[model samples]
Target: MNFLKSSVGRKVLMAITGQLMVLFVVVHLLGNSTIFIGLINSYAEHLHSLGPFVWLFRLVLLAMVLIHAFFGIQVTLENRAATPQKYAVNRTLKVSLASSSMIWTGLTLVLFIVYHLCHFTARLTSDVASYAGQVPGDVYKMVLGSFQHGLISFVYVAAMCALCLHLYHGIQSFFQTMGWNNDTSLPLISCIGRALAVIFLLGYSSIPVFILTGILS
Candidate 1:
């Protein structure tokens, strides 16, 4: 209870959950990349075959996301309250845009995630229904068909841009919050984080672009 009430505790919770979510993102991208190699259908089927475990995994991921978001907002608000006044010297010129807009980027990602679940996971949208076939588990077809739409592809690419920004800052913060970085190593860690973020952005954004352009059909 004391830990939950403390600001440091909240930051620690956010860091742990953020790292877990990052891992999930990497795994998800790798799984989705199977589309390029022509194995996405089988991969999707294998995930579905997990039956109850799939739901269990989803529930765990949902819990992590909620906890991460909650603590993230809490910490951001507390920081603002602590330093309500802007620095007259304006020393933040060195900060990256992503680091400065964490809250906004995070909120954008939350909205994107909800839309993504509805569009793909729940298959609630007509866009998905049109291509997923009578069987609900044809995830490959669903992904390919949905991305064929120019607007959907654009939205996905835009979301990936938001995700990249969020990730670049979040990864560096993760290391900092965990007390794993020192003066000598912080620069390297930051560079690695940014590299990972760019890689993820390009990898995910390419899927929609490839699909829409008939490169992956």
Candidate 2:
């Protein structure tokens, strides 16, 4: 319990939670990529049938998300508090805008997450009624149909943009929290962070772009 009260403990918890969330994202991205293999429905049904334990997974994910967000906000607030007085000497902010401005990007991502849940997770959609008495095509059809609209595609692009920014800062932070930071290894970690961020953003963004171009039609 004493350890839990320590700053290092809180950071460790945050890192663990962040890694869990990243793993979930990786699995989700891999699952979504099945659309390219022409078995999106199979993948969707597999996910949809997680049964009662799905709720357990959701709860775990929720806990991780809230903890990570709370700790991030706490750290940002602490930084702000520490800088209550302006320094006489000119000094650049130690963090990047992507890192410092995470609260706004995070809020935008949360909205996107809620929108995604409404459209996919909760199986709610503008055309849900049309899917009545239908089989478990709930997930696939919604994603396919949403892309038919230019606005939805644009929303996806924007969300992916924010996500990439979040990941760019998050990946390296995770490494540092894990005690992996070193002069010899920091550059490599930084490179990996940028590469992963760019690749994920481009890969996810490609889906909406393809749809908007009528390639998926």
Candidate 3:
């Protein structure tokens, strides 16, 4: 209980959960990229075949999201309370915009995640009707049909931009919290983080863009 209340412990928890979420994003992007190869339906079917285990995985992910958000808010508020005044030197100016806006970005991501789950996973929109009469789990058609809408594709691209900014800060913060960053390696790690964030942004954003442009149809 004491550990849970400690600042360092909360940071550690955030780091661990953040890493798990990152891994999930990477794997999810890779799996969804099968759309480019015309195998997304197969991929979706394989995931559906997981049956009860998929719900178990989703429960674990939900727990991670909640815990991470709770601790993140607690830590951020604690930091602000501890300072109580602006930094004498305004050191935040030295950091990247993404690093400075972690709280806002995180909150935005929470909303985006909820919308994404409804749009893709729950298929709870009228848009799903267009893909009805297809195979039972024709996720590819659903995805394609959904993205064909200018507004939906625009929202997806905008959310991905937010994701990119969030990831750019998150990756470096994860390493620092884990005690893996050092003066000599910090620059390299930051660069790698930015690179990975861009890659993810492009990879995920391209699907919607391509669909909207009729390149992937």
TM-score of 2: 0.89
lDDT of 2 at 135: 45
> 62-178 in candidate 1: lDDT tens per residue?
999899888888888888888747677877789789998899889889999999988887777888866444334667778888999999999989999999999999899999988
For candidate 2, lDDT tens digit of each residue in 72-182? 678667767877577786466676877866777777887888888766665566744465444456545666777888888899899999988988888888899899899
Pairs of residues at least 3 apart in sequence or in different chains that clash in candidate 1: none
Runs of candidate 1 exceeding 4 Å displacement: 131-136
Instruction: Report the lDDT tens digits of candidate 3 across residue range 25-59.
Output: 99999999999999998888888789899989999
Candidate 2 deviates by what RMSD? 2.2
Residue 103 of candidate 1: its Cα lDDT?
92
Clashing pairs in 3: none
Reference-based lDDT, each prediction: 0.89, 0.79, 0.89
The deviation in Å at residue 64 for candidate 2 is: 1.1
Against the true structure, what is every candidate's RMSD? Answer: 1.6, 2.2, 1.8
Report how far off residue 126 is in candidate 1 (Å).
1.6
